[model samples]
Target: MFSTGQMIFAGLFVIAFATAIFITYQKDKKLHAKNYKGAVWVAVAFFVFIAILFAIKYTLKN
Candidate 1:
């Protein structure tokens, strides 16, 4: 069980950590767009590959 002080510290820590991450992401937004232009297609391909693997497994299991 957490004490009142530990709970307060955890709440403050989460707020500070999230604020830091948001600020960092905003700072790098432009660089990320330029560097990761084709990233969506890569994600799509990964999903499709996984689907194919699942289909093969299903067929073999039956």
Candidate 2:
């Protein structure tokens, strides 16, 4: 069982960590948009490829 102080510290740590991450992402948000324009299509293609593989596997298994 954690002490009250430890619990409080954990809560504060989580809040600080999330805030830091949010700020960092916000700073880079514009750069990310400019540099990764085609990233979404790449991700969609990757998922489609995986789905095709799974379909082939299921077909062979049956």
Candidate 3:
């Protein structure tokens, strides 16, 4: 439902936001690596928990 101009503006805003985030992350890459070493494992654990919950729900349904 948005006009063409609004769509273009939204696209530009997303580009700018992504660029800013990239620049910021690049600047702090070393700090993030040092401070967040186990973050990936945490994300995996969270997904596993969600999957287990869904599997239990499906089993109960059947």
TM-score of 1: 0.91
TM value for model 2? 0.86
- The segments of candidate 2 whose C-alpha lies over 4 angstroms from its true place after superposition are none
For residues 1-62, write the lDDT of model 1, one tens digit per residue.
99999999999999999999999999999999999999999999999999999999999999
> Residue-wise lDDT of candidate 3 within 1-62, one digit each (tens)?
99999999999999999999999999999999999999999999999999999999999999
- Model 3 scores worst on lDDT over the 10 consecutive residues at 25-34
Segments of candidate 3 deviating more than 4 angstroms: 1-8
lDDT (0 to 1) per candidate: 1.00, 1.00, 1.00
Considering every candidate listed, which one attains the maximal TM-score?
1
